[model samples]
Target: MISVVLLGSGNVGTHFFKAIEKAENVRVAQWFSRQIDSIKGYKNKTAITDNLSELMEADLYILAVSDDAIATLSSALPFENRLVVHTSGSVNVHDLDKKNKRGVLYPLQTFSKGAEMDFKNVPICIETLDKKSYPILKEVATSLGSPTKRVNSNQRRVLHLSAVFVNNFTNQLYRIGHEITESEAAEFDLLKPLIMETAKKIQTLSPYMAQTGPAKRHDKKTIEKHLDLLKNPEHKAIYKLLTKSIQNTHGR
Candidate 1:
């Protein structure tokens, strides 16, 4: 069996570890985390260690830590010849020194602890230092039902930025919408249907083609009224700026 020592049992690590455990010919030899108490449950199924040298038995050490800590943690790991892979969307795979076989296994999706993941549907981008490790990485991803794509460093960085705009930025907009409706004693649930429809329409219609609202139609009165209704300075500025941007993008 190909063994894995997972580092940092955070959201990404937790999710990946669970999925990998279910796969054939793969077993988690151990898990490493700073918060040993928090990740103790994982230790019941496999050995869990706080020491770095305990990772020597595993074929690969998957560093699921933050991008900022990748360098320091990679340097701290003791094994020179063991395959080292980091699961990060933005960090370059080459950031790991040439001492070992280094690679990346970046799953392009948001992971929340205790939430189920359908790895089959999520795209997995893989990158590697040498050809020898490609098969191992690809097999690991494919076994989890994820469709694998080998991406270079530059393309992965660009995709990470785009994902942020789509997932993170769009979520903030939803939060803002919820706050605005609640302040008026209106339930945010009322907007759920409209939000669902907007997303569905955009799947088939080009985002520009699916455009609606006052900004698209140049309904100056409605736009002005919305601006007037927004009492908070920050919210009002955001509304105006987004409206102007939307109009500029889709209007004459």
Candidate 2:
């Protein structure tokens, strides 16, 4: 059995704990949070501590902390030569203090508190400074039923940047759509199907092939109408920028 000490209590950490708790081959030997109350609810399931010195022996130390904290936390670990991995896409594996064996097990997915996540579909990007640590990280990812991909720090950074475009930027566009619908007293729910269909199309069709609507068609009249309808300058600016981007992409 693979035993792990999970150090962090935020969204990624919480979800990791829940998934690990259910995995038969792996178990969380301990959970650490700066403030004990953040993980107090799990006290009944595993050892919880706020002190680094109190951390127990485990097969892996998974630091699911914020990107900024990974280095500091790993440096502060009271032991060395142990397998230590962080769940960060952009942070380099070498960022962890050399006191311990360092690696990364970045789950390439958006995480939010109180949201359900199915690890089986989450692609875990794994990287390790030491060759031997690769299989160990893969085993932990497998324990969560997640598919693993070997990614260098640079590839992971590119994936993370692309994710920001597809997930974060797309969500902001949806918010703008919601605002636009509200301005006309229209139901935003009306656009839900379109959103789902757009997502579904990209599954079987390349995004370039799936492109549609005024910008892709170069319907200048419709584009101008959209700009005129957008009362907010920020929204208009975004619309114009995206329209230009789409037009440029299609050789307009």
State which candidate has the highest lDDT: 2
Tell me how far the alpha carbon of residue 154 in candidate 1 is from the true structure, in angstroms, after superposition: 1.7
**Alpha carbon deviation, residue 65, candidate 1 (Å):** 0.5
Total residue pair clashes for candidate 1? 0
Error of 1 at 205 (Å): 3.2
- Listed per model in order, the count of residue pairs whose N, CA or C atoms clash below 3 Å is 0, 0
lDDT of 1: 0.87
RMSD of 1: 1.6
Can you tell me which runs of candidate 1 are displaced by over 4 Å?
A: none
Angstrom error of the Cα, residue 125, model 2: value is 0.7
